[model samples]
Target: MLNNWVDQLNNTRAAAAPFGEANPKMLTAFRGLNAAQGSNGALDAKTRELIAIAVAVTTRCDGCIASHASAARQAGATEAEVSDALGTAIALNAGAAYVYSLRAMEAFGQMGK
Candidate 1:
């Protein structure tokens, strides 16, 4: 499963690699999102890379997270910024798992009594 996810993520990154000004529609379409539309023309390459990293982490896409984290650093994201972003991801994942597991079990115990 992990390797499958990794291959899928690599394929996705290839799809999103930027081309030239002739056709920026991939970054402007319904697929790219309305709020983030026009980014292909407007945002700096470095900024885009950082956002990609954040998205990877948020999705818990381990392969994508590793790839984009490296890309972000290469594009000038600082160690501090990268570490903070990853730390937030870790905290959120842990919190969600704890609630779903421990809190649910606690609630179940109360109901059974």
Candidate 2:
């Protein structure tokens, strides 16, 4: 799909290096949030990563998809589970497009003479 995710993951980390160096506090805060969110809280790692993957898909974020999908695999999500999550994301995205099309139709009706 996109770049090989392993390569992309390395690239993402490398790219973030400059920003992290320039703003250590912000980077620390972000890492803290990531750590806290991904830990064994109410939701386990696999579930959190699956949710993240779904969110990444819905948001159309290539980098997020790469990162979260890799994390999801490492967190023990089976291919079937990932596929199911992606299917849900696909349906939601399509549903959003379908609903938004109705807005366009409404606008056209109002503007037509």
Candidate 3:
């Protein structure tokens, strides 16, 4: 079986504990940000998680993906909804890549001058 992402998250949290302990201010700030961002107000938990998952994919963060995906599941997101959200992520990634490739091509052209 593949390595469990939840386990990976647990391990990362364990490893990060020392840093968090050593940097109380940073940890406090992080906790505050997490609480503020994670709260469900106008948007439901599931929707917030879906947005998080999409951003995680766009940012290419494995930890965020695992954490948010798990949260999405716990918040009553179905497999189909998760799949659809990922599909949206995939499309956005592709579009971003295509747009950035134009900048890459421009840079390459400038380098020859």
Candidate 4:
């Protein structure tokens, strides 16, 4: 395993407690945002969790990955589904890099002029 996700989740929550205490308003707002996502009922929990996992991977957020991975499992997402989501993340990252590479080439050509 890449990480002890369960332990990481526990450790993350422990570490966040003080920060949340210090910024109660921010924490509450964040919680409210999360609640709002579910309130729409447009997507089921499993789909939301899968999307969260993909976003976490794309954003390179370990804490979010751990949290959403567990939630995905709880929401009955299969391993294959998670793998497919990861593949999407990989493609997106590569596509972003490709686009940035084009920008870099453009900047390099501009520098020559």
Q: Compare the candidates by lDDT and give the number of the best one.
A: 4
lDDT of each: 0.69, 0.90, 0.87, 0.93
Candidate 2 per-residue lDDT over residues 1-113, each given as its tens digit: 53688887788889899999999999999989987874657888899899999999899787898899889999999999999999999999999999999999998999986
What CA RMSD would you report for each candidate? Answer: 7.2, 2.2, 1.9, 1.1
Clashing pairs in model 4?
Answer: none
Instruction: List clash counts for every candidate, in order.
Output: 0, 0, 0, 0
Per-residue lDDT for 11-108 in model 4, tens only? 98898789898999999898889878878789899999999999999998999999999999999999999999989999999999999999999999
lDDT of 1 by residue, 15-113 (tens): 665542345775556345845644667876566766676767778677667677667777788888777766766787788888789988999999999
Full ranking by TM-score: 4, 3, 2, 1
Q: Using Cα atoms with residue i matched to residue i, what is each candidate's TM-score against the true structure?
A: 0.47, 0.84, 0.86, 0.93
Error of 2 at 105 (Å): 2.5
When 3 and 4 are scored with TM-score, the better candidate is 4
lDDT of 3 by residue, 1-113 (tens): 65689887787678678988899899989879989985659898999998898889889887888889889989999889888988999999999899999999999999999
| lDDT assessment of candidate 3 | 0.87
Q: lDDT at 37 for candidate 1?
A: 43
Candidate that would win on TM-score: 4
